[model samples]
Target: MMLMAAVLQAAVVQPAPGMLVERRLAEAIPLAVGDTVRVRALAGSAQPRPFVVAGVFEREADPNRIARNDYEVRLHLPDLEALLPTHDRVDRFAIVLAPGARADPAARWIESVAFGTRAYGSAALAEETSATFRVVSRFHDAIGIVTILASAIFLLCVMVIRVDERKRDMGTLRLIGVSRGTVFRAVVLEAIGIAVVGSVAGAGLGVVVTRIVNAHYARVYDTTLRFALVTPRIVLIAALLGLALGTIAGVLAAWRLVRVAPQKLGER
Candidate 1:
């Protein structure tokens, strides 16, 4: 959540008043923290002011991830005296609201002001701020849904086959004075074993894949892109989901098999 908030803050880039904003350029001078830099004015002013550098950032400028041009640079913000020399123009501001303050009310208040007639909020602000978080959340959702559906289909098939294969065995057990409850429990245990194995293997594969991708990307770009690494919480949820799905399939299969009479089993 901290990472999400930090990324959202970066995504919402609104320059302060009279600051000249420049995109990352090719063969640009690299910047570090506390490095003072200067930016050419958009108005083509003769002199450039030494602006104290706050920070530097690197990110893919592409909206779509497939085609990407990676760029890195520092943003140079001009001071007040620097603003006095150039044609004064303040385009936008990135406002950080206090925790207790409602963004909607603040936006409305800004709109009520005479100068705030052009103020816009809500959808536009969200688009600018929450792009990365929304994309990543959707991606994770799709992966999780697919994993559950695939597991369900696989478990269903396994349960159906196991029931069919053990029909004669189940019939014999019933004739030998075993209750239907015993048969149900045995079937549930078998399903539990299958679910445990599958969940463990799948979790291991996910971890390996994440590590490989992370290493590859870092080697190529030297940039840290946060991956959705599996945690204990995620693993626990996956296990619970898998066990539930498997038990349901197994019980349904076992119930249908138990309904068959011993005589019917002999005919089969």
Candidate 2:
């Protein structure tokens, strides 16, 4: 009753026999205002009945909703009553309270008055439904941690190989009275530059992959919901992590090269 009251508040319908089609249904059937369409209940032996398209309505957008859009249509109370064998009973409905009203207490009150009804706050319903999405997020976090470890190891190995190649040059600089501190700073800066370049390339590759994956899944699933999200913050954080790993790798590589005696650098 309360739900119906809310809908009736904004609904300006004539006493004529017609039904409102959801935007998705309207577009799918190529229906226009005043077009007549046959509707039938999914269950029972009810035969199809013709109804004029009174209006079209788009469902409110919910970005976080994982479910696909519903092609629901609404009819007037009396029309619905004739179509459904519901017998003046509604199976489910939601209630909106006044502003600043307490949900827990209102839910309790509603349950008390409405026997055989279970009323829970919207927060509870949202949490219950979003549980799977939360699990997927944790899985992504685990993969990220493993990726970071692998990246650190690979960066270290590359830096060690690079420093080994430059051993002769480092030894020559040391012989020319170049201080170890200046030599260390040079190697560190080179590593940082490599990291910056790699990070930018990786970000670009990620964007391309995201587009491909999203487009492929959209075709497969026939849904408009996004399967992945890549934000600027995520990219920035990855770049910073790369820089930190580069700095650490540079320090270790520089230390290995500088600790060797300048005269012995020519030896394998």
Candidate 3:
């Protein structure tokens, strides 16, 4: 009862007129605590109102805000009203429900009370807003598939050339009584080694590129949001995929060499 009473009393009371400025806005305007700033609403012809800066805050690092990057000022309801010509009117409201409260019911109740207003759950809002990202993700997936296909084809070609170059040596080994299985294993092992080395080099390059990209973004945006990330899991997946492709390519190339007569392989 005491806690509820205190909360009610606090709700009934209004704090002194002051606004919190966004970090970007504060830095751009060079605002500090206790500094006075003149602000005017863009919607109305009201003259600029003097306001004391209570605090400077960093905006939440969110995907939605990254595109807009708008400056913001948070002030009391009365102070906001005084700055603009409008009175007792609000464009939007954010409601926080208690634990175990259903969003649909709360949203319905809010819409019932507030005519001409639409309320959406977090999931619905995300689904509606994330269409662009979904499209971009699909495009990236398509590009990745094409890139993998190209890389596999290129690897096959490289293996074929390498095997062809060593044909005479392989023929000599076979003449010296080296078994077909031994030669096949040698080629496969070479492919596996190439895949391992390539995967490591690629991972290193990816990490370095990600760092460069993130640094550029940080310098430009003054935010810590990273544009690219190279995690261990991703690196491991690439290595495994490389190994699989390399093994397959090696098998095909080795088969071409082994099926021919040793005498034919010795020819230029």
Candidate 3 residue lDDT tens string, 4-58: 9999999997544688998888899788999987888888799887788999988
Report clashes for each candidate as comma-separated counts: 0, 0, 0
- Residues 118-215 of candidate 1 have per-residue lDDT tens digits of 55565686687677779888997999799788879889889889888888888888898999889888988888889888889988997898899878
Cα displacement (angstroms), candidate 1, residue 157, comes to: 1.0
The RMSD of every model to the true structure, in order and in angstroms, is 12.3, 7.6, 7.2
Give lDDT per model, in order. 0.69, 0.82, 0.87
Per-residue lDDT, model 3, residue 14, is: 59
Q: Against the true structure, candidate 2 has what lDDT?
A: 0.82
Q: Give per-residue CA lDDT, model 2, range 56-82, as digits (tens).
A: 986654545436545678887777777
- Sort the candidates on lDDT, descending order: 3, 2, 1
Against the true structure, candidate 1 reaches a TM-score of: 0.63
Model 3 residue 41 CA deviation in Å: 0.4
Q: Which residue pairs come into collision in candidate 3?
A: none
Name the candidate, 2 or 3, with the larger lDDT value: 3
Worst 10 contiguous positions by lDDT, candidate 2: 61-70
Report the error of model 1 at residue 199, Å: 1.9
lDDT of 1: 0.69
